[model samples]
Target: MTTDGPPARRLMRWRNAVWLAAAVLFLLNFVQRGIDLFSIILTAIVVALGFAVEHVETQTRRPFKNYLRVALASFALGLVLVAMPLLMGAGIWIGLILWAGLSGAALFWCTYYERTEPR
Candidate 1:
């Protein structure tokens, strides 16, 4: 049990490192591209990866309803983000902050509601 603890800790640390690296890379890509099409692509890829991670962690097959909900949420969020510059015009920064907050909230909701039992 003692030996297993160290191995488990090491694996956890490695997993964290991988996630951190992915986040940093995504950030760099967004910053370099100035949050246009590239940002959308990156966000989609990240979201897909997140879904995959959730699938693995929960050990359950994807539910159609959940997938539909996620897709609708993502589309709505993307629309808001795309319209932000035009809607706010003078306060683009505020729109960006709102977009970030919305994304965070959506991710939290998904994580919290994700089913853990096999389906």
Candidate 2:
């Protein structure tokens, strides 16, 4: 079911905070270790997806906007992960492919939810 109100806003804030924390950790990992950490990248990807999926706006829900947001966030996160020195070349292609697939899936999900959701 769709959600809004204070609880959803709180959840959105919490998710964004988590994403920021994960992003900070990711940057620090690179700076300190001078190398890419797979785990940190994975954390970032998960955090980004989690934050995007919260869909916390109080106004009329817009699935297309959500799809765009998810797509951009996924691409940004995927770009960061694959651009690391450790995972280059094939990783670049893989990351882009994954981003496209994820965006498409998110669009499908958002459309489906919009139709099935109680209005």
Candidate 3:
């Protein structure tokens, strides 16, 4: 009387195996194609621009020119970061490391300036 129940369980197992196989195939495709840089560059630019806006709000009390100056500087820096790999023939990992180093240096400089400047 329970034969139909066993068939349902068997079908469920096969369905799970098929789903797992499809998922594995999808993952392998991505591993083969490698990561892309365009999205990364766009993300970096947005973040840098956001930081520039924040910096202008907090650090610069001057007119709109100062805001433009800070924002433009940050944008230029981000552009250079995004172009480093193409310009230097560096791999993605090296470009990321270079960007990190430059960002760290900029952060340090800002920290020092904030401490030393009159509030």
Candidate 4:
């Protein structure tokens, strides 16, 4: 036999839904407020993925320095590009788009180079 929930059970369902919605909204606001930090994180993750193409773990113990340098330089370049009058004047959205596109291109180039020209 199928069982239908009682009134209290139905309320429990609504309670869970409310909690989930609250959590989602909170996360959305948090991300919106820290977009710059998120952008940097995205760049770092892409750089790390590029390095993964060559099995970064197999490299020398000192390779971390090189990887860190590349990630930092990429992040700095992204910030500079976003801050330029050309992009900034376009609007914040445009600047963010440009930053993402540049970061992706840089990461892809890194991956391609590592794949074809092993050290």
TM-score (all chains, Cα) for each model: 0.38, 0.42, 0.34, 0.36
lDDT of 1: 0.65
Worst 10 residues of 1 by lDDT: 53-62
Clashes of 3: 0
Model 4, residue 91: C-alpha shift (Å): 2.9
Lowest lDDT sum, 10 consecutive residues, model 3, at 62-71
What digit string (tens of lDDT, one per residue) describes model 1 on residues 1-116? 25656766877777788778878887898778778874687588666766665455445445655654565565566556756456446546666677778777876676667666
Per-residue lDDT over 1-119 for candidate 4, one digit per residue giving the tens place of the 0 to 100 score: 66568876776687568657755765686677765775566556554554553343344343353454456656666666665545446556666677788777766766666667646
Q: Cα miss at 105, model 3 (Å)?
A: 0.9
Q: Per-model C-alpha lDDT, please?
A: 0.65, 0.65, 0.60, 0.60
Clashing residue pairs in candidate 3 are none
Select the stronger candidate by lDDT from 1 and 4: 1
Model 2 backbone overlap count = 0
Per-candidate RMSD vs. true structure?
11.8, 7.3, 18.9, 16.5
TM-score (C-alpha, index-matched) for candidate 1: 0.38
- The superposed Cα distance between candidate 2 and the true structure at residue 7, in angstroms, equals 5.0
